[model samples]
Target: DVKVTQSSRYLVKRTGEKVFLECVQDMDHENMFWYRQDPGLGLRLIYFSYDVKMKEKGDIPEGYSVSREKKERFSLILESASTNQTSMYLCASSFGGRPGYTFGSGTRLTVV
Candidate 1:
């Protein structure tokens, strides 16, 4: 079974700090994604990579960026964290065209 691991479960940061959220998958999935869960907006995709060294921006990619240097690792970067960016961040991995995905236990971030 595929297991997605997130580096941190909770995070607190100041208004202008740069935050790095890491996700790793045990299965060599071809697709990896980063999404933020907000109350009203639901789960909005921030970034995704289909293969190593390749990425495509999702609906809400303005305040974020992603790196997929290795097949099992994907990293999400917040250039400068802000209060509005505070939310539950989820990482997921799946085989392309597969029916289901494996997700990490999310990282809840708060910016003061």
Candidate 2:
């Protein structure tokens, strides 16, 4: 089974602070994604990478960025976090053109 691990389960930061979230996958999947889940907005894609050194902007790419230096690892960066950005962040990995994805446990971020 594919396992996605998030570095942090919970995070609390003040407004205007920079934050970094890391994710690692056991499977060598080609596609990795970062999503921010809100109550009504559902899961909104922030960023995704198909291969190492290649990335694409998703539905909600503003104020966020991603990196995929290795096939099994991906990182999400919040450039100067804000209060409205506080939400549950999810990381997912899957083979390209697959049906479903293996999701991480999620990291709940709170900006005060």
- Candidate models: Cα lDDT each: 0.94, 0.93
Of candidate 1, the 10-residue stretch with the lowest lDDT total is 94-103
Clashing pairs in 1: none
| Candidate 1 ranges with C-alpha deviation above 4 Å | none
lDDT of 2 by residue, 1-112 (tens): 7699999999999989989999999988899999999998899999998899899999999998888889998999988999989999999999988968999999999999
Identify the candidate with maximal lDDT.
1
TM-score of every candidate relative to the true structure: 0.96, 0.96
* Model 2 per-residue lDDT at 104: 100
RMSD of each: 1.0, 0.9
Off by more than 4 A, model 2: none
**Which pairs of residues have clashing backbones in candidate 2?**
none
Let me know the TM-score candidate 1 reaches against the reference structure: 0.96
lDDT of 1: 0.94
Output the TM-score of candidate 2. 0.96
